[model samples]
Target: MAASAPTLLSTTSRLRVSSAAAFRAATAPLLRGEASEWVVRGEATVQVLGRSVRVRLRKRLRMPATRMEEMRATDVSIERGDNATGVLTVASRVSFFSRSSLELVQMGALRVHAYYDAGANDPAVPAAERRARAGRLSSSSVRVGTVLLPNYELRAGYNELEEQIHFDQSLGV
Candidate 1:
């Protein structure tokens, strides 16, 4: 038993080191600003026309891996449970006679599938060619009601012109 204890301790120490190394290797591409894709699935209750409606949302989004990481960091600081602060934007149209309004009531949960494109970070490739390889790097889509709502695109990242971190989010149907 004494020998087994030391063996277990050494194995655990090696495991911890390997786990940290694996994490860094996995995230290195994102740290280098490679492209990433995300498919977000969630359920929520929304108020539309004074009636409460339940919805299952499946949203597909693509952007720079670094920006995605920043958005995730911002999400960690969310204070409200039901309502998200700028994390989600809802836009609905107003019909002639009746005024239509959509408000999010509660967010159930979110399941996100993230994919990183490591090839975009190839140093030998030209910058423009890298971008071409990561085609449609920034795009988003979500379904509203029975119709698929069109995307109003925006990106979050360091803005060279603004000289600061810029976050823009808007949704339109």
Candidate 2:
């Protein structure tokens, strides 16, 4: 019998911290290239391949309370130890009332194992093997982002011919 083809998979991860300061502290080492492994939890970790940060905007907002709307963005490439590299565009907003938030604008490509059901019920395959092969799929074929915010605020163009995924969301804070 011919060998089965290798599978490819993709995934997204969300992380929330108590405060933006904490988030910065956690990512400081990685950003400085001091570390490569980011321990998301006890056993779950991701390898930081590279990262770059830029100040998108910095201004003073004189509403609700006098606060600085300093928006900084970072482009990061990470590996889940699965040989898949996930590139992400993340923005961090630090404002008053502790009403801070992180925005993830996902683009680029990642890869993983692809799962097929051609021989799903084969008893020869172990349960763990079957489970891994059940839902493993590549992450390169997905696009998740905000539209209205990027369109009206940033005036970002979305050309289907370019396979562009442009989006944004603002609470007008």
The candidate maximizing TM-score is 1
Q: On residues 58-153, what C-alpha lDDT tens digit does candidate 1 reach at each position?
A: 545342354222221221222222234323322333111111111111222212223344556768768986666552233332222121123211
Instruction: Superpose all Cα atoms of candidate 1 onto the true structure and report the RMSD in Å to 1 decimal.
Output: 22.5
C-alpha displacement of 141 in model 2, angstroms?
Answer: 42
Cα-based TM-score, every candidate: 0.25, 0.18
Off by over 4 Å in 1: 1-28, 67-173
Error of 1 at 110 (Å): 23
lDDT accuracy of residue 72 in candidate 1: 17
Query: Could you give the C-alpha RMSD of every candidate to the true structure, in order shown?
Result: 22.5, 23.7
User: Which lDDT values do the candidates have, in the order given?
Assistant: 0.33, 0.29
Superpose all Cα atoms of candidate 2 onto the true structure and report the RMSD in Å to 1 decimal.
23.7
User: By lDDT, who's the top model here?
Assistant: 1
